[model samples]
Target: MTELLYLFDDSTECTASVLSCLPTGDGLYAVTLDRTIFHPQGGGQPSDIGTINNVSVVKVVHTPEAVLHLTDHEVAGEVVLKVNSEKRFLHSRLHSAGHIIGLVGDQLSWHATRGNHFPGEARVIFEPQDPASVKLVDCVQFQAQVNQIVTQAFARVLTENNGIRTVTWGNLPAYPCGGTHVKTLNEIGQVEIKKIKLKKGQITVSYALT
Candidate 1:
């Protein structure tokens, strides 16, 4: 099994020396490294896309023993894996945004029935029994307040206790998650809520960063 560097330390970025690489049966290159920072797609989030020695990494897939990097070309020599910083950053931001919506909405007694970070567009669907109590305007206002919390640049703490990785959003929300996230709430910035619908004891809240 490969040691997941990102799990222990999400801040680490590079691995200086890499060992042998092999093509696994699942159409993915099993690149063994002394260390890595790539966060594989798991826990309801998509994988990271970048390059290994300048060759584009098409996708990062999870395996029982190792995280595979499916690259654009067959790699050789002492390989170097580079995760797309922009994509990683954006995904991180969006993931935390989803968590914020989940935490705050839960605090307000609005339970999230389904929540997802859909690459470019992330959303959290809530289920509130009395839909009339929370208006669309209320969602907008709630988003405004979320941005305020984001602006504070709160610190992030990651921990694994009892076999579950927890992503803690500052001081408010502490929940188990395996997805990548920004180190601070300020990175989330201003967000927009949309697609408010009330049906069958549910209130859906969709989100986008503005």
Candidate 2:
């Protein structure tokens, strides 16, 4: 397993040793690092795209064995891995915003089943529950509620224990996750609750950044 540097450190650039570089044809190679700062596509987030020693890293994926970085060149030796800061910041915002929505869902007794933090498609899916026992909130009220939750400073807590990683925001519930996130709730800025809908016993909270 590759040492995931992004978990503990949010730095965009790091130096890594190229473990193996296998050609995947069309002048592309699948490179694996001894450790990496790149976040693989998983946990409702997309892969981090950047450059490895000037070689373009188009995509990153987590195999059962290691994190494979698809690059345009066959690299070797120690090289610098530079994660795209613009895309990373956007992804962090999307992910943190989604988690905040999940936090609100928990307050409403609507635990999140899953979430997608991709840009323009960010939404939280809640488990199906008894409608009679549920209290619904409208989009406007939901946004207000989110504002109430996020306006205060909420320091992010990322912890790893026994190979398991969890993230928490202030007094909110800690969630098992592996994706990247904002360092603080204030970094998430204004969250826009696009819509809140409950249908067929399931609930969906659609959100975006303002």
Local lDDT at 52 for model 2? 98
Best by lDDT: 2
Clashing pairs in 1: none
**CA lDDT, candidate 2, residue 47:** 87
Each prediction's TM-score against the native? Answer: 0.82, 0.93
Indicate which candidate wins on TM-score: 2
Give candidate 1 regions above 4 Å deviation: 16-34, 76-78, 128-137
lDDT scores of the candidates, listed in order: 0.73, 0.88
Ten-residue segment with the worst summed lDDT in candidate 2?
Answer: 128-137
Give the per-residue lDDT of model 2 (tens digit) for 68-178.
999988899999999999999999989988888887777777778888999999999987445568767677877887878777688999888898999988878888899
**lDDT score for candidate 2 against the true structure:** 0.88
